[model samples]
Target: MTDPMILSGTSSNLDSLRSQLIAGSEKVQLQIIPQLAELGNQGLEVIQEFLWQRREQTPTPVDGKIYQLLYSCGVPEIKDFLQVNFPQGVVPLKSEQGIDYIPLVELLAISDFQAADRLTIQKMCELAGEEALKRKWLYFTEVENFPVTDLQTMNQLWFVYSEGKFGFSVQREIWLGLGKSFESLWTKINWKKGNTWTRYPNEFTWDLTAPRGHLPLSNQLRGVRVIASLFSHPAWDNKK
Candidate 1:
């Protein structure tokens, strides 16, 4: 079996380091991203802190995996990072080669999707459409309220979604649509019922099916299809 990796930093200094990273400037030393990446659970906690604090500077831009981490934490830095680094065009989130601004989502959620990286967002919005971006965000909030059962479940949930395409599937697209009309839909629907099996709480209940140790994006598409069906159901759509 492969051994779990441990970070080199001391436990005592961890908190201070994290606080500094969270509250510190955007031009943080490049080393911080890797250190936090290696820090295991400590690193994740720091990432959350950074998202919550919503620092407005250039966030530590690590590889895209870190961007996925930030997204799971309700941060999406894709648009902002693209604008700042490549003012000439849209930067899609792909493999390690793609620009991964985990910080962009952070800026979007905190600023109501008004990105500091205006150029990229403006351009991408044209390509992906304002609604696609809106839907992407909607998925974030909807997933956030999902009953995780526990912190461990929550962690597992993040692992599945961040690593696999299933998490980003069709359910997400539907949720994104829902996000555009969140206040209205959320107000009418029974949030209590949102936790039921059919609503997608089942993904966690079943064994993770990430393909050959990798997340399949198709799974995400299927999930959205499911969500769309539910929303379009006769009962759900007919409600006054």
Candidate 2:
């Protein structure tokens, strides 16, 4: 695993890396891609074949990694595949407060939905000011102060990477579509099931098959005000 993670690429290791990619743990699979890329065309050929194998299934975070790596590899065929299938391009990390959203983008790109969700909360708290960042949550008033550009940028990272399945904007759309009904929105996004709230970690679907707008979860536990403020945010008003 250590070798695959950091080794200089060589022709002899090409087949070995390919085999590791096919059967390796997610950690290995992800780490080995750079090693694979280091092998040049030989490495890229492996990546191309690997990507083709997963073309039918939903794109994973590894798919996002490949999308970025392929651009660096200078392969026309792979780049074309990216242009068609992953047209979201690189998500813009716009932030009025100069917050770094690259980590959020990276997590989303790898399809690490839960990590992204956690980071989403962190970023929102960051937007709310230092006290909120220290407390790790938001007051509804703080939500109103969130910069529209930052929110839209965060939403784009989640929305585009998740095949349009998730994001705060998607949640806002759901909220508006239901005539701004919060209870209905909860049920629709699977945040609640009948009388009971879905338990975190155990009940949330953390993947593409989860209900639409089910992710990038706002701090809904403090009641609907936070999410309500988020849904009502002017971020939705601006045209991208």
- The RMSD of every model to the true structure, in order and in angstroms, is 17.1, 10.4
**How displaced is residue 75 in candidate 1, in Å?**
15
TM-score of each: 0.25, 0.66
Best candidate according to lDDT: 2
The CA-based lDDT of model 2 is what? Answer: 0.78
Give the total clashing residue pairs for model 2: 1
Quick one: best TM-score, which candidate? 2
Off by over 4 Å in 2: 1-89, 219-222
Q: State residue 53's C-alpha deviation in candidate 2, in Å.
A: 23
Instruction: Evaluate all candidate structures by whole-model CA lDDT and list the values in order.
Output: 0.36, 0.78
Clashing pairs in model 2? 61-110
Shift of residue 137 alpha carbon in model 2, Å: 0.8
